[model samples]
Target: MANPTNFPDLQVPGGRMHDDQELCEHLLRSLDRPALLEILPSKIDLGGTGLFAKEVIPEGTEVFRSIPLLNCIGHEMSEFMCDYCHTSLTNGIDAAGHLRIAGDALPTISRCTQCGVCSYCSKDCQRKAWRKYHKLECPVLGQHPHASAEARALYRLIAMVKQDSLSEQEWRALAYLKAHEEQWSGHLEDLMYYQPQVDNPHRSTPLAFAVAARSAVRGAETLMQPGIDNLQLYGLYFRILTNDMDVAGPLHPNIGRTVDLVGSLMNHSCDPNTFAFFEGRQLRVRSLKPIQAGEEITVSYVDAREGFMMRHDVLWFKYFIDCKCNRCEEEELRISTLMSQESSSFEDFYQAEKELIDIRNEVSRDYKAFRSEDGINQVKTAISTVVSQIFRTQPWPDTLLPMCHMKQILAELSFKLNTNPNQIAIYTLQSCFGITQRSGPHWVYALHSLATHLTPMTAALNRLKNTPPLLLLLALIMRLLAPPAPPATPPDCPATPRQFWDFYNGLLYELVLQSRKTYGTDSACAVALVEKYARARARSSWLGPEERPLPGERGFAERFGEAQVAMLG
Candidate 1:
């Protein structure tokens, strides 16, 4: 049968699809409610689909939210994180596997009494999980407490499919997502070598598929779901490989994965206007910039802040699409032209870029390497290496996106280490400059980090007083960072008669407002920032009454630019 969505038939191995044709048809049907955004052929690619705004979407506006069709905590994190809300329960845990919050600081989390695994943040989450698939999964999970995360997640999907647990609208929404099965079609053989138990590993298979197959087979036996076949199981696996999103929030202690049928409708762009954040089980998509009517709503499939080559590599290998976003196209052209013009410049960039990539690859291969004390020193070394190579060219080209990406990583590492606050501010500011000179998601989050880092302004100000360059750069950026109009009433700080503290309070207030727009009000980051502003403002009030400004701070402005440049070095 012809595919209803009219994308190519799923590239199932041996061209065999056991009883999946109905699903192919089902995916094309409409959802129960009218979609918030229009689904249409993408202007970026022919025969591809994308989501578009139906009306003007102001920056910080929430475009849509959806509960995951399925969710699972990562295997590494399943022990400490709530299986339902994905909250961390580490602090509350005791030896007996019973955990409760004192003073109701947070909802209490408890391990499943029967399974002694899969903690839930509240009884409500437990009941929701039970009704969804936990009732079928709990007994199986009890017997095999060590099932891989993918197995646990896929088992739920298979059981739900067999029992018709999914709402029809959900099944329809999922059908709309097309899988890149061809990417996995070539990995079947390698799968069986690693995992012999899978009845029929495809002729081409990778170890990842083998691991997934091993989990699926074990789960099948444990669940005893009738009619669950190899092709059916593999079909679900490929969909997850293609469409699953990381369940992440600024407050999340560890990342997990989930499949949100409607959330999967948006396509990838290296310059996406919308970003997704998770609140408990709900996924919310919000605009990062003002999106006018008819504008296509896009989200980055990979980290958009990465250099072009890295972004391209991920897009091609994982999603099987070549990004043609304007930023990607321009960066690609600029790099090629720069190489043709100056071979030495290109060679220098290439060598430095390769080193950074190697460091990243090493960290990915062994995450522990980036977390150890030794890893901290290695990152310090990497930062020095990039900084040295960066100034080699006169006025480093902004197109060297990798340099910015390197700075971003260095900043994150610095923040994680929490050893040197000065370095964190410098690296983060440098990274933000490399991408865009404007306020954006990067700026919002970076400022949030700084504000959060420097809270209780008295001590922080005293600590950073010696670093005038840092303060000066922050003031300049935050001034430039202000939106055309304030999102809310400015906290009682006046523009004239401004003390540096006035600007500082303004910065904190603007950051709190912008963060709420960018990350939704319910976001943990936004909430904390708001409270921090209130306390900071109150403290400023107690300091003293404001006086009219005295002028005549000569030559400070001229020295500002020069000092900043020297400080950057």
Candidate 2:
């Protein structure tokens, strides 16, 4: 559906307007509609504040999906190019005939074996090269002395072009280069001039080169489509390839498109709602929280914990903009010594909160002893104590502790369970479940806490089903504790999962009526028990078939039997 102009306006919780309509319109147009809507706030208040819904949405809802406005595949798809051969080091191949993987040693240019325009280590490399576009351009290279460089330059050119739909001028440029191989050399020169150059005596063609470069640059500028960013960084790398011919790179197939869309929209925030996951080719956006309709959707440009100065520096380099988010505003407020002193009093008190510290230390020690002995009982005791403390503390649970302290406790427990998935892990998990159940049937943390414990417990259960009874007990506990299906409504909004649970239970009650039509009331009771146990805890007060209906009570089977038969028929 097309984006509606009348969608609710979103503002900060306390009636803050981050941007006006003109800015919002510009931002929305810049983003793909689906991506924009994924982060948009649900409703806007007249005061221009955005408040998120308070319900928890299911985990795998399709938030936003989109095809890139521009798509590009790297040249490696066309040829077997070595590090020394490819212009983009980020997408370079190595001597082993493999795409150079990132975060590894840089491949040496000297190892490159020239097969034609492209270089490889051996025949296997040549074959790999041929599978790529190399075969298409290989023959033409032999026709021109500068074919290798020309092909490399053209590959880089085509790679960048893939990110956007080519305009008529770009289309004509591509066709012309394809028709006349020498034209690639002229285009390469134009790209080089677009980047800043340092003085070098060995550089070819002094005055004529300068004149040709200036003319080509001006000509290229005229041909370029409007609205495209200058992309000076990519241009700089292009210039480097022209100067230093030996640089090799990684096989970043998605670099072109990633830079085109996500890279273009990159913004910084110390706290961000949008997170990106790269799934091979496409970049996916997940909402960490419910975003309001008109709010500017933002992603963390760097790790969140970095101090303001460091984070700001990184964002400036990437997005070329200064961040002025709430966190930064907090940092600015902290700079005043008077304000800092006042804030520090509460911060110190919170930091030194004795009850939190004692529980944390106890949990930590219990974890260590359990790990050393591989003792399930010890782990169980520790987990139980932690969960007890979590609930006793009211709203702020143990899971919401300060990062360092929370990580420490989680790490210790995680280590014991991860290293040894025995009875101890089950007990530790059951303790979490016990706390969740005790907390309340409808507690929000109940499902999340159970899921955290069960994820590992499930794997262990699969491996140790035939082991001890205690282990099996733990597994069953974990299974029973599995998080309820994600809440039907968004988390920050007013709706609660309990409402949805009631609706779902109503559906199950109806299903029981259908079962009675096929099997009779006695069988219907059994089905009800089974379904109820699967979805929720069994209650002692639940009626059985032998029991007569009370004054105002209706048996589920008797009340809905006719409807069930009609549905079946």
Task: Please report the candidate that would top lDDT against the real structure.
Answer: 1
Which parts of model 2 have CA positions greater than 4 angstroms off?
1-64, 67-257, 286-294, 304-310, 316-322, 327-569
lDDT per residue, candidate 1, 247-270, as tens digits?
666534236677876557677888
Cα error, candidate 2, residue 440 (Å) = 24
Predictions in order: lDDT: 0.60, 0.35
Q: Candidate 1's C-alpha lDDT?
A: 0.60
**Candidate number of the best TM-score:** 1
What's model 1's TM-score? 0.69
- C-alpha RMSD of candidate 2: 19.8
- The alpha-carbon root-mean-square deviation between model 1 and the true structure, to one decimal in Å, is 9.3
Candidate 2 residue lDDT tens string, 1-569: 02211211111223122233333343335443343342123232122223122333222222333323222223332233332223223333232333343375763322223333344434554464455434433433344324223233443333334333233332321221111113324544554564444243212223233333343333323332212233332232233222211111111212222222222232335665554433222344445445554455455645443344545654443223467777677754543332244344433433333344555556644555545444534544544554343234332333232223333344446544565443434434433433311211112122323333334433343455333323233323323234342222222333122222222233334333332322223322224333442433122123222233321246633533322222222
Q: What ranges in model 1 sit over 4 Å off?
A: 1-36, 41-45, 75-81, 87-107, 110-117, 138-152, 162-164, 189-226, 250-254, 337-375, 382-421, 432-440, 460-500, 520-527, 546-569
